[model samples]
Target: MRSIAKPATQHTITANAKVVDQLPFQDRQAYADARQGFIGTIDPLVITDDSGRVVWDLEQYAFLQDESPTTVNPSLWRISQLHMAHGLFKVTDRIHQIRGFDISNMTVIEGESGYIIVDPLTSVECARAAIELVYDHLGERPIRAIIYTHSHADHFGGVKALIDEDDIHPGGVRVVAPSGFMEHTVSENVYAGNAMYRRAQYMYGQNLSVDPTGMVSTGLGIALSQGQISLIEPTDLISDSGQELVLDGVRIEFQFTPDSEAPAEMHFYIPEMRALCMAENVSHHMHNLYTPRGAQIRDAAAWSRYIDEAMRRYGHKSDVMFICHQWPVWGTDSIRDFLTEQRDLYRYIHDETLRLAAHGHTMVEIAEMIEFPEGLATTWTARGYYGSLNHNAKAVYQRYLGFFDGNPANLHPHPPVESARRYVDFMGGAEVILAKARRSFDDGDYRWVAQVVNHVVFADPDNTSARELQADALEQLGYQAESAPWRNFYLTGAQDLREGVRTDEATLGTSDVLSAMTTDMLFDYLAIRLNGPKASGRNFTVLVHVTDTGETRLAELIHGVLICTPVDGHADADTSVRLDKPTLTGLALGAATLTDAVSAGAVDLSGDDELVYDLFTLFDTFSRSFDIVTP
Candidate 1:
C-alpha cells in the first residue's frame, strides 16, 4: 500500500519518443550481431544454487520482446532486447561464449584437450550453470586454465564455482591474471565493499520490479546474479605488455592495460584463432569513467590508449572480437571502425572535459556543456547506455581537479539535511517550493523539479505532498533515462521516498572474499573497523598469531587509531592471541565473537584476554542499508 509508482507522464513519453527520431533506430546491425552465433539455451533459463534459491531468471526480461513502451527509453529498450538473448553461442570453431548468464560473458576457448575459461560471471550459481551449458553442448573437458582479465568481482568472483585450490597447482588448471589483481580485488571488494554494495542496489535497481516502468537492462547485461560470489588467488601473474602464454596448446599474447577500466586489467589476443578479447575495456556502449555505485574514477585517457593499442596489435589479424559484456564484433573493417569510434568516445570525453575546465568552467558547468561530436554521437557504441555524457564529463573534471569547484562558497558546504532545511527556508518554506515545483513538473522540467523537491523531502521527510511530487519528478526522469543505472537510481530513489527503504533485498555476501584474504589484508580490514571514539582515551596492545599462515601481527590501539604491523614474536604486548587463519577469518566475518572463539578452544589467549576482548568490542559493525533518499 505504501508503493505509489505511476505510469509515464505525457512529458516523459514525448521525450523518449523523440529519441527514436534523433538516433538511428533503423540500424539493425546491433541486432544481427547480438543474435549471431546463437546455440541452444535452457528452456526456462532460470539458474539456482544447491539450496534451490533462484539466482538468475531470464524470464523476467520477457517483457523486453515487445515494441518500446512509452514508459521506457527507446534506445535503452533496443539494447535491453539484445541483452535478453540467453544461451550458449558459438563465436568461432575454436571459441564459444556463454552470454546472458550473468553481467559478464564467459568465453570458452577450445584448447588441445581441455577448455580455457575467461572472465566467469559474478556468482557461483551462474558460473556453474554456464559450465553445465558448455558440458551439455560441447561435451565435458578438463578445465586447463581460467583467465581473469581484470580485478573486478564480475570477472573473477565465480572462480571457486569452476575449480578449487587443488586445480590451481602446477600441471592442473592454471589460474592466470594481470598484475596487482589480488590487491585491487581485495581493496575494491573488501575495504569499501559494504558501502559500494549499498549504493549498487540503487544503481542496479535491485529493489525495483522488472516491468516496462521498472528495470529493463543494466546497459551491460540483464542483471547481476544474486548468489554466492567466490574468489581464488591466481597462480600466474602477467605484468609485461608483450607477455605470452601457451595454455592447452593455444598461444595467447597479452597487452596489460591497468587503470583503464579496472585497476588491474589486460587485453588478450588469441593468435591461433585470430580472435581478440578486449576484456571490459571495449563494450557496445559508453562506459562510466566514474561508476554511480562508487569506486576509483577510471582513467579515460588511459582507456582510449588501450583500445588504440589493441587496434594496432590485432586489428587486421582478427576477424572476430569478443568482449566481456554485450555482443561481439565480426569482420576486420567493422571491428576497426568499432575500435576507432570506441577509442574516440573516451578520448573525446576526457580531452574535451579538461579543455572546458581550463576555460574556467566548473565541474557542473562542464557536465552541462560537453557533448559528443557528430560521428561519435551517431555511433551506436558511443551512446551512453551505461555511462552518460553529463556524469562522465564531471568524472573527468573530478580526476584532474578535486571535488572543490575553486570557489570558497562551494567549499565546506553544509551537509545534506542541514543544507536542505536552509534552502527550503530561503525559498519561502515547503508549501511555496512545492507549488513552484509542481508548475515546473507540468512544464516537463523534471530535472529542475527533482532537484528542488529533493530539498523539501530532506528538510521534512514526513511531508506527503512534497514526497509524492518528488517521487513523480524522479519517476519521469527514470522513464526518459537512456542509461539503465541512471534510470534505476532515479526510480529506486522514488520508491524509497514513497514506500521507505527495503532492507530485505540488500545483497552483499563478502565472506568468500574475506576467506581468500591474506593475513596482512585481514589486519588491514580489522584496523578499518576500529571505532575511534570508543578507543580514544584507552591504549592497549594485542599480538595476533595465525598458526596456519605463520603470520604474527602486533595490533596496537593508540590515540584512537588501530595500527597493525608484522612482528617476529609476541613481545611488548599486554595480551597475545593465537589462532588459525580460518578462526581469524571467522572473527573478521562476524561469524563468531572473540569470547565464543576462546570458549570453543579455537583461540588461545594469554597474558590479558580481557584486553583482547575489549579490543574486539571496539570494532564497529556497519549497517548494510543506510538511509540515502532521506537524512
Candidate 2:
C-alpha cells in the first residue's frame, strides 16, 4: 500500500528495544544537568521575527514529554527530551546561558562593568530573543564584548543582533575570534553555500514533520532557528594558544584548535568564572569527523588531542564546563570524566579505523568491523546521535587512503542510473528483484532491502510498486536509526519518493551575508557560480570599481574559468563599471538587475554594457532543494 509514513515494523521495534537494554537509560544525570540552573522560560518558548514568522518554536516538540515510542530510537528520544529545557539559566552566579532558543547555546558572562556574550545563536531573532530573556530576568547590562568561540555560523551569525555595527570600532565593544575566521566562514558559508545549504535541509530535517514518526531532534539540539543569519567581522583575532585577553575585567585564555571541528576553531578558559567553553569540539554526543552536509574531512586524531589539551589545561581548575551545544557539566571530577571519555571517543575512532585499514580492510568493511571499547561505548556522551561510527570510520578511511579501496573494479564504475539499469537487467528484471526485496523486507532485513530496491526505483522512477516498497524499507530504517541525521535522511528519502522535492523552500535571501563579503570574496563566489561549459570558448574582461571602498577588481573570464585580480586601474579593460559596493553586491546576489541599477543611476557603465550583462548570463543559479534520493 502507498503511504506517506508507515508504522515501525516489528524488526524496528525490536531494534529500538535493544537500545534501551544496552544503554543506561535509567541514569538521570543528563536530565538533572539540563535543568540545573533553569531560571524561567516563556511557556511555549516561541521566538518570532518582526513580520511574525515563527523562527523558533519549542512548543512544537511538546510531544517529547511522552514516553519513547516504537517509531523513535530511545537514545535519540532521551536527548530530544533534554533539549526541551529552554530559557535563560544561571550557569554560575556570574554566568548565564540561553538554551533551547536555537540549535546552539548562547552564554552570558557578567563582566565587572557590563556583559560578555559568547557564541550567539545562528539567527538574529533567536539571539535577540535570548538576550532579551537575560535582560528581562537578570536586568540589562551594557554588552562590553562579544566572543566568538568558533567559525561556525551558529556561533557568530547573530553578532549584528546583539551589538550595533557603529559600535564595532576601536574603544568600543571588542569582537574576538580565532585566526582565519573570516576566510573559513565566507568560504564555507558563501563559496560553497548553495550546495551546503541544500544538503543542510536533509541533515537538519528542516522540512520534516515534527512527531515520533519524523524529525524529533537534530541529535545536537531540538531544531535550527529559521530567522535571518547575519555576521560581523571580528576586530580581534586569537592567533596562538596561550593567548590571553582581559575584557571588562574578565580574563580569557585561548587554545587555538585549527582543523578540528571547524577549519578555524578554539577552546577558551575563563579564569575568573572557572568556566571552560569547549566550543563545538566536545559535545554531548559523537561529533562529526565528516559532516554529511559536506566539507573537508576533519582530522580525528587532532580532534582527540585538542580535548586532551583542554582537559589538562583547564579541567582541574574549572568549576563548570560549558559547550556550544547541549547542557553544561559541573564539578571538577564530572568534568574530567566527561572530557576523558570524549577524548577517547575520537581517538579510538581514529586509531582503530587506521589499524583495521592497515590489515587490508576496505572502507566499507572497516566501518562494519570497528567497535568502540566498552568504556567509550556505554557512555551516553560518546554515542552517535549526530555523527555515526559507520560514516566516520569511512571518513577516516577516505581522509587517509582516498575513495579508492585498491580494487581496480571500483576504480571507475558506472554512474547511479546506468549502474542500476544494468543491475536490474542482470537480476532478471524489476518484478523479480521486487519479489526478492519483499521477502527481505518481510524478514526484517530493511537495510539490504533498501539497497537492492533502490536499483529498481532508480532504473525506473515511475514504477509505483518499486517506489512504495523502497519507501517502506527506508521508513523502517529511519525508525531504527540512532543518529538523527540518518533517520532524517532515510525518512526524507522516503518522503521524496512519495511526495517529490518541495522546490518552494529552495531560496534564502542572503543579502546580509553578501554585505559582509569583501570585494575579493564576492568575486570568488561569482567565480564559483560561473558555469564552465557555458563560459567555454567565450572570453570577456570586466573591470569593477567600487566608489565607496575605492577597491578595483578585474575579472577575466577565459579558458572556461573566471579569474579575478585586484587592480588599481586597467586602461585596456573591455568594460569599466563604476558603482557603490552595495550596488555591485546587489547585482551579484541577483537582488537588483543591471538595467534597473543603470537606469536608477546606481551603476555607471563606460564600455561594453552588453558584455557585462552577458557575463552575468554565464553564472548559474543553484537549486537549494535538489533531489537527493533520486537522480
Candidate 3:
C-alpha cells in the first residue's frame, strides 16, 4: 500500500477554520471537568513491552499542543487536546482512572485486599502499562477481580495482560461480564471479520498520520494502541437487572443491556462508592448506532430505554458517573442531566425517524428531514463526535425497515460500476461531468460534486483529473464534518483516491482470537467460506477427529449447503482427518494446506485423499484489501 500524501487544499482550510468562529468557545467546562482529579503522569508517556518495543506512545500527537490549524476542525481539535491528558487521576476517594494509556480508559477501584480492574484497554501491552502506572503510583496491589463492561474488542482484548490465565484457573480470580459476552465477541469479529476489519481501516483512520490534516482523534480517544489482543472467558455472567455481586468488599449491581452499543453489554453500579459505571452506553459524545466499520444495526429504542432505566434505578443515588471512554461526571445533578439528555438524543432520533418513515419518506429523506430538538441539541454531550444524527437516523430506518426505501426504482438498482457507466454515458462524457462538477465545487456545493465525481471515477478510475477533483471535494466535506468518523472516512477516501487503496495484511489472523475459537465456531466460520455454486450437486461427508481433545464431528456437504453434526464416530464417512485444534485452525486460515499438514505428520488422513482435497477446494478465500471507493 502506498503512503498517504494528500494534504488539505485551500478550500478545505478556509471552510474548516471558519467553523472555529461559529462554535461556542465559552464552553470550557469539559476541560475543567477532565482535569479535576489529576495526580501525575508518566513523563513523555511512552510505554514499551518486555522486549523494549514501543507499544503505546503519545509523542506522535505532540502537535496537538498547538492551536487548531486551518486544516482541522476546531471542536474536534479541542477534544483531542482533552484526550491528550494522561496518567493516574483520582475519580473519587476509592476510584482511580488511568486515561490516555489506550483508546479506552482503565478504571481501578480500591478493594478490601487489592484492586478490581474494569474494562482493560485494547491490547495486552497497553493494559499492562496501564496497571503498571496504577501500581507505580498507588503501590503494588494484587488484582482480585476483573470486569468487562461490554463485548467490544477494546474492553476485553487485554485480559491476559493484567492477570494470568493461571490466576483465573479454578476461580482464583473473579471475571464478571454480561451473558453471551464470549459468543458475541467472537462471532461479531470472526464471521464477517475480514470485511469489517477492512472497513475499520477507514472508520478509525489507522492509515492516516497523527497530524492536523491527518488523524486528530477518533472522538472516543486519540487512537487504538498497536499490541497483542487476548481474551479470557468470563467466570460469572450478569444475566438480569438487580443481579448483584460482592467482590473484595465492593458491591456491584448489574443492569443488563444487550443489543445496545454492542450485542452483549451491561452497566453496573457500586453501592459503597455511590458510583455508576455506565459502560459504553453513555460516553462523552453521541455513540454509534450503526458504526461505519459495519456491524448489525443497534436498536435505538432499546438503547434509549436502557439509559432511562439506568437513570431511574441509580441516577439519584450516584454521586459520580464514569464510563469506558472519556472523563467522569461528578455530582448527582450533573450526572442526571447528562443521562437524561443522552437518553433523549437517541429517543428523538428513533421516534422522529419512524414518524417520517410512516409518512412514506425514504431513509435518505428521513435522515435529512429529522433534526435534534433545541433542548437536546444545545447540550455538548449530545453533539455528534462519534455518531452523527445523519447516519443514526438512517440506522433507525434500517432497523425497522431495511435498506429498501420501498421504492421500486431502488429495489434492483445497478451496481456502482454499471450505474456509473450508464450515468457518465447519459451525461455526455467524463469531460462534461468534470465541467459541471467544477462549477458545483466553486459554488461550495461539495456534496453534489462528490456524488457526481464518484460516477466519473467509477466509470474511469484512471482519470487523474476526475480523481483529483473528487479528492478535493471530499477534503472540503471532511473539513466541515463534526463527527470524527465522518471526517476520517471522507479524508481517507480522498487520500486513497489520490494514492491507492491500502494493501496491508489483515491483523485478525495474528491475534489471540483464533486460539479462543471453539471447534463449533471454527466450523461455522468454515461454513461461511463454503462456495455454494462450486458445491452444487456434490455430496460428501467428512468426519473430523481431534486427537488432543477426543472430539469428533461430521461435516456434510449436500445440495450447496454444509451441515455440521457432533457424533461419536461416522462409520460410512467419505473422508476422515484426525488433527488437533491448532492444525485445524491453520487449515481453516489457509496458513497450512491439507497436503502440507499430512506431509508434516500433523494430520492423519483416512477414507479417500481425493475427497478430502475436493472438500478443501470447495472453500473460497476472501481478500482483506478489497476496493471500497473505485469499482
Candidate 4:
C-alpha cells in the first residue's frame, strides 16, 4: 500500500472542527458507563494465530491514547478512545463480555453446567483469544451452546475457535440461530462475495495505517481481524416471536426480527436476568440501511417496527440492555429512552424520505432536504458515525422508489467512460476542467471540484494534473466527513488515484465456509460466475456425481443461462464426472484445475473431456482489485 500525503488544511475544515468541538462535550455519561464493569485486560494486547501471523493488535491504535487531534473529528475520537478500552468485564453476575477483542463483542453467559456463548467474534484467532481470556480469569468451563443473533459473517464466523464438530451433541451442545440464517449467510458471502470483499478493503480501511489522518474506529469498533473465518450450521432455529427455550436452567425468550439489521436477525430476552439482548438492531451508533460495501438495501420501516416491538415486549421488564457492538444501558429509563430514540431515528428517515418522494422529489433532492429534528440530532446515539443522514435518506427513497427518479433523462444514461469523454469535450477539454476544478478546490468547494475533476480523470486517466486535483478534493472531503466509512472511502479513493489501484490478491472464502455451503448454494454461486455472453448459443448438459455425498446434479446451459437440478442420472449427458465435494469445492475456488484433478485421480471422467473443459471456460474469474474511482 502507498503512503498518502497529509491532508491539506483549509479554513472550511478548521471551521467544521470548531463547530464539532462546541457541540455537547459536557456529556460524560457514555465515558462513565463504558468503564462500569471493568475487570482486566491482557497486558500488551497482541494476539496471533497458530501460524504466528498477527490477527489482531490493539497496539496499532496506541495513538488514540492521546487527545483528539485537529485532523480527527472530536466525537469520533472520543468513541475511538472508548473502544480502546480492551478487556474482560462482567456484565452482571453470570454474563460477561470481552470487548475490543475484535470488531464485535464475544459474550459469555454462565450456564448451570457450562457456558453459552453469544456471537463468537469475527475470526477464529480472535474468538480463541477471547475464550482464553475468560478461562484465565474465570474457570475453564465447557461450552454447552452457542447462539448467533444474525446471519452476518462477523457474528458466527468463529464457531470453530471455541468448539469442534465432535463436541456438538444433539441435546448437549446446541448451536442456535434465527430462521434463514444459513441461507442468508451463504448467499451474502458467496453470490456477491468477490465484489463485497473487494469493497470491504475501503470500507474497513484494511490496508491503511492507524493514525489520526488514516484509519480510525469504524464506529462499531476498530476494524475486522485479518484471520481465518469459519462457520458452523446451527442446531436450533428460532422461527417466530415469543419463541422460548430453556437451556442449562436459563430461561430465554426470542424476538425474531428478520430483515432488520440482517436478512435473518433476532433480539432475545433473558427473563431470569431481566436482560434484553438487542443483537445488532440497536448498536451504539446509527447503522447503515445501505452499507457502501454493497448488499440488498435494508428496510427502514421494518427496522423501526422491530425496535418498537422490542420496546413493547421487553423494555419495561429489562433492567440492562446489552448489544453486540458497544456498552450496555443499565437503568430502566435509560434503556427505554435509548430504544425510543433509535426507533424514532429510523422512522424519521423512513417517513420523511417517502413524504418528500410523494411530493415529486428526486432521491438526491430528498436526501438534501431532510434533516433530523433537534430531539434526535442532539442525542449522541443518533449521530452519523456509522450511517449518515445524507446517504441513508437516499437509501430510504431507493427502498420505495428505485434508482430511477422517474426522469427520462436518467432512464438510460451512458456508461461512465463515454459520458466522461462527452462531458470533457463539452467543457472544452481536460485543461479547462482542471482549471475550473483548481479554482473550486482553492475556494473549498470540494464537492463541486470532485464532480468536475472526476470527468477529467475518466476522460484522460493518464493526466497527472487531473488525478492530483481529484485526490486533493477527495482528501478534503475525507477530512470533513463525520462517518468513519465515508472518510475511509474518500481517502482510499484519493490514495488509489495517486498510486494507481492496488492489485493485492485476496482469497474469496475459507474452506470451512466452502464446506458448509449447501449444494443449492454452491449451484447459485456457480450460476453467478457463468458468463452469459460466452455461453450464448452453446447448449450442453453435464452430470456431476459427488461420491462422498452420494448426490448427483444435472446441469444445462441454454439461452445464456445455466440451470442445475438434482437428479439421479442423465443418460443423454455429454459428459459425466465423478468427484467428491472437497474436490468440487477446490475446482470452484480455482485451487484445482480440471487437468490437475484428472491427472491426480481426484476427478474421474467418463465422457467428453473437451465439453467439460469448454464449460469451465465459460466461467469468469473476478479480480479482487477492480478499479472503482476511475473508469
Report the Cα lDDT for candidate 4. 0.86
**Model 2 C-alpha lDDT versus the unseen true structure:** 0.89
lDDT of 1 by residue, 428-533 (tens): 9999999999899999999999999889999998998998998888999999999999999999989888888876433333366667788888788788888889
For candidate 4, lDDT tens digit of each residue in 1-631? Answer: 2446675476445756775665687888888888789888887988898989999999989999897776677777877887887889888879999999888998899999999999998899999989999999888989999999999878987889998888777666889899999888877867787888878888887766678787888877888887888888888999999999987878899999999989999999998899999999997778999999989889999999999999999999989998998888997888999999999999999999998899999999988889898888777898888888899999988888899999999999999899999999999999888887788888888899999989988988888899888988887777777788888888888889888887866556436876677776666677888899989999988898889998889888889988988997555688888999888877776556788988999999878878888988988878899998888
Better of 2 and 4 by lDDT: 2
Q: Point out where model 3 deviates above 4 Å.
A: 1-18, 50-52
> Using Cα atoms with residue i matched to residue i, what is each candidate's TM-score against the true structure?
0.98, 0.97, 0.97, 0.98
In order of lDDT, best first, we have 1, 2, 3, 4
In terms of lDDT, the best-performing candidate is 1
Overall lDDT per candidate, in order of appearance: 0.89, 0.89, 0.87, 0.86
Model 3 Cα lDDT, one tens digit per residue, 277-372: 999999888899999999999999999999999999999999999999889999999999999998999999999999999899999998888878
Question: Lowest lDDT 10-mer window, candidate 3?
Answer: 1-10
Off by over 4 Å in 4: none
Cα lDDT tens digits, model 2, 435-529, are 99999999999999999999998899989889888999999998999999998888888888888777854343545656877888778767887
On a 0 to 1 TM-score scale, where does candidate 2 land against the true structure?
Answer: 0.97
